[model samples]
Target: MNKTKNYDLTIIIPMYNEYENMERLEKKLTGYINKARMKTCVLLVNDGSTDGSLGRIKDICERNTDFFYISYDSNRGLSTALNAGIDNTESRYLGYMDADMQTDAEDFDLLLQHIGSNQIVTGIRARRKDTGFKRMQSKIANSFRRRMTGDTATDTGCPLKVMWTEYARRIQFFDGMHRFLPALFSLEGANFKEVPVRHYPRTAGKSKYHLWNRLRKPFADCIAFRWMKNRYIRYEINEKEL
Candidate 1:
């Protein structure tokens, strides 16, 4: 699995106005990079952060040899940032996490242990540390999306995940496709694994999602996913000539 990669893994961290969490990101990520089971580097994708996050990202990347970055002129939202990160990834396996630090960085090792066989291995926030209201909203959204797309996912919203570069690139790009990472990979008969991991409360920065996007937007995205699922192409070649 690691044979063809420049590094064994490339962890993609997408930031949007996360100036407050920059130092935390550096500290947490550096610790993981040093102790990770596989050779790992980080790609910090800047989504046009207005709170001086891009500058901090630059400094972090400059000081750390394992860190690199790609920047956009302005904010283009999470899905776009995720796609760009995947597109730029040069490793055989790609990992993803949020800048908010709600998810533990060390738990990525747990997800990585399952990626050798599965095309996608994602974390499940077994014990989420959010308010009851926030948890309820996520629960409702997850249920609705699962019913609509027929996806057997427990917590696709968990930012910590590891996927083969091929599978990551194969995912069809859409505005809210990040919410359906499991379904997108499974759509092509790709194997997937779900592992329970630690979750934490947001200590700094603001949550990008809210009542509308958290609940309503996913409903619309599920409909979009359903439409695209029906139309998405699939194929297998017993023999081929190039």
Candidate 2:
């Protein structure tokens, strides 16, 4: 018998003024999760959206049994929104996707399969649908990050990922932290993997990031991470005697 004890997965979607794409986002996400044959639920984090996104999120959560939402009154960056979702979730596994719908939701199942052995597994955009300029910017930023942090995982900015809830909670995040997930996980000494996943073009709602914000911010953060990495204290406690 398939026991319906509780949800096994919590999918967190961070939204910021995405009113135009809210309904479609709900429909597509719910449909994919249902088809995946897992006890999955959604956690919509409204990052201080000025539009009617929060109301729509509340309405959907109220009407749908497996959907839920929480919001902040003021705008915080993606790291804070994601941290809020991580702190709020009560599930065995945690998943993350952006509100832009650039990545396929079904890929969560693919990532979920690898979560047992690995604390984190992320999707790599096989064929990114973003513009040439955006792609170039991402390439430069990723190259710099790899050199600085030495995480050595391609496509860290893919925006779709699954992580064990424990590992997710253990992450020490700060501003612009979303870009360095794999690096941070490595710092925690957690196993992580990357799998190829499909990518799509943004159909509605404009991207919140620009060239400066996306690439330059990460560049600055890379310098900060270098400092933190050298000063980081890692030790092993062999046995506990009480």
Alpha-carbon lDDT, every model: 0.90, 0.88
In order of appearance, the predictions have TM-scores of 0.96, 0.95
lDDT of 2 by residue, 1-242 (tens): 21112678888999899999988888898798778757898899999999888899999888888888889999998999999999888788889999998888888988988888999899999989999999999999999999999997899899999988888888877888888898988998989899999999999998998988988788999999889888877788999999
Off by over 4 Å in 2: 1-5
Q: Each candidate's root-mean-square deviation in Å? A: 2.2, 2.8
Which residue runs of candidate 1 sit more than 4 Å off their true CA positions? Answer: 1-5
lDDT of 1 by residue, 140-192 (tens): 99999989999888998999999999888888899998999999998888998
Best by TM-score: 1
Q: Lowest summed-lDDT stretch of 10 residues in model 1?
A: 1-10
